[model samples]
Target: MFAVAADDCAPSDPTLTVQAYTVNPQTERVKMYWQKANGEAWGTLHALLADINSQGQVQMAMNGGIYDESYAPLGLYIENGQQKVALNLASGEGNFFIRPGGVFYVAGDKVGIVRLDAFKTSKEIQFAVQSGPLLMENGVINPRIHPNVASRKIRNGVGINKHDQRRCLLIHTGYDEERRVFAEPAGDKFL
Candidate 1:
């Protein structure tokens, strides 16, 4: 996964930040990178193939998934024991306010997705981000999201197996223009 950010300077300005993570869940290995905007090339931050273990699990993780016009998180965002952005309670427009939008959170060794209301009362949350009308809930696709929605857009989300807490799923959907259909779900493991 990759993330890039730039300051509000002119196009010719050289103030940017880029981060990339290469994760191999099957081998439990991770690689990271950092690059500045001065035309400097990417630099490895964690050159070693880091293992994901109880004693050395990832210290922090961010969605870097989606955002809004103002570049603010379009959904819920929590970091370092603080709610950086409150659970969105307003309604009307946008994908985030769709009924049943959920929040993904990590607390201790546990990771979960819960409805926004449930999140308000949740305890011990270490990191969190809210996004979307759930893509799936209780093993079923969210009723509000239809396969033939007006627009076909790329989407991504996180899910956890109800019977296996250790197994988390990251899903990304893209359209195969040639086939005129969404591509098969790409699944990735978390930690």
Candidate 2:
């Protein structure tokens, strides 16, 4: 991933360094995996790449959002239209437990970011991963996200363009020295 766009916010303003990776599932095979199809953890990206045959170069690879303390995906996970881990709705501490946690999914020729309850009846999903405290929903920022909050955690998030609603936008930001998950506003059009 690279800086697809830089913000126009002045130098004196609160800052964040951001990079975005855009995925078009139509021409790309976007799938989630924690292990091999045979049900063995591939252990490393290199080993997984070696085991599975793919066409063309891998454009991007990223942490599949917040996982459990053991590093397992903490919520719903779907790969290639197959349900792997069921959606988690339990409440507790940490980012994953944040109320209104949602999922980023790819289904048929579509991509979406959906809230927990709304995701229940979704069908034909090709790929999906759940993560907490949605950055934005219906163009409104999550009420819990305070740009001035003391949390200085650099976090990554997935979203779909509102206007076009086609591509999946993967964003990773520069570290927040405080080391906890938080959010910041990216520009209207990230170039």
Candidate 3:
């Protein structure tokens, strides 16, 4: 819910942005924070009171939207000039390993998504996250997704405006099929 940006940050800068979300399991409340890299303070963004089940666990949290089990990213993760988890090329389990799962990255003044194979050889990535079944690729919805599929779940994805690298988009599709959700631009919205 919170987003941070440096006063005069650019993509080439290592400390461009940071976003954090704290989820309280006991209270089922989620708080978001955003701050610029090296900033003195974090700004509160959103405090969401999530619905909990009888067991005191969030009933319908968005899975795969944030951290995965063990608090590790479900796909490739890169930060602070280091690759946290190598690009996953093998088809294993989960949506993350879906064939052709792609990487969303920021480098210099550019924001883009490329197939994992291509990302492995790239030398300019500054930050990145890998996610599967790309909702869209090269300006088109992935052919793998069909409109009539019976199975539907809350889903989220990132997109960058090809015309302007600085303008990025975060899309969250809730369980309801009739409504569309779009988020405003944030420093690390793609992440």
Candidate 4:
């Protein structure tokens, strides 16, 4: 489910450019290399996980990141054994439908999408463990975890339906209850 692909170039030289790709299956491990872009053969990049992914996501901070109540809009590049960077970012909310092959789409942010051909529409639904704050139930919106629906810090809210559908919704309001929507504008309207 996780992988990285980059141009064959010197790491110390930024000009040796590489736009990380996440679709390569061979880059799943901590260290790997490719004979060419889109090549069928891959060599080795390194021998240790610590040397490559020691700092976790390349663009992520060592102390604060997606975990432990920290988050950001920037896509975190988590590397495996090689310096292969994969986009590790959060997902958008609203009207999400996972296709039979695990293709997922949100209400917005369609310009760039990642597809995973693993989800089955016939897969059995199951309950999932939750963390952080609960947004609302019926009419009660709990703030103990998020404190306010308008908090820019909490971009999404977690919830569970009566039928047990674990959901995460985009918070349209700010911590002050003001109409402060996030996500990029799709065509003309902000999502």
Best-fitting candidate, scored by lDDT: 2
lDDT of 4 by residue, 1-191 (tens): 11122232112223422111122212222122222344322222232223444655332101111232222212222212222222322344321211111121121111111223322222121111112222332334323323233433323322222232222221222233321222221112211
Q: TM-score for model 4?
A: 0.21
Please provide, for model 1 over 1-191, each residue's C-alpha lDDT reduced to its tens digit, 9 standing for 90 to 100.
22112121122112312211222233332111222334332322232113222354442223333466444666566654666567776786767667777877666556677877777635576667777676655555556765555544554455675556643444433442211121223222221
Q: Give the Å shift of residue 53 in candidate 3.
A: 28
lDDT of 2 at 135: 70
Q: What lDDT score is found at residue 49 in candidate 3? A: 20
Clashing pairs in 1: none
lDDT of 4: 0.23
- Ranked by lDDT, the better of candidates 1 and 4 is 1
Worst 10 residues of 1 by lDDT: 4-13
Q: List the RMSD of every prediction in angstroms.
A: 11.9, 6.5, 12.7, 15.9
lDDT of each residue in 81-186, candidate 2, tens digit only: 7777899889898777777788888787677788898886456787788887777666666776655555556666777765567766776556653212323343
Deviation in Å, model 3, residue 109 alpha carbon: 3.2
Q: Candidate 4: where is the Cα deviation over 4 Å?
A: 1-66, 69-129, 143-154, 158-191
Please report the TM-score between candidate 2 and the true structure.
Answer: 0.74
Ranked candidates, highest lDDT first? 2, 1, 3, 4
User: What TM-score goes with each of the models?
Assistant: 0.57, 0.74, 0.55, 0.21
Question: Candidate 3's residue-wise lDDT over 38-59, tens digit each?
Answer: 4322221122222113343332
Better of 3 and 4 by TM-score: 3
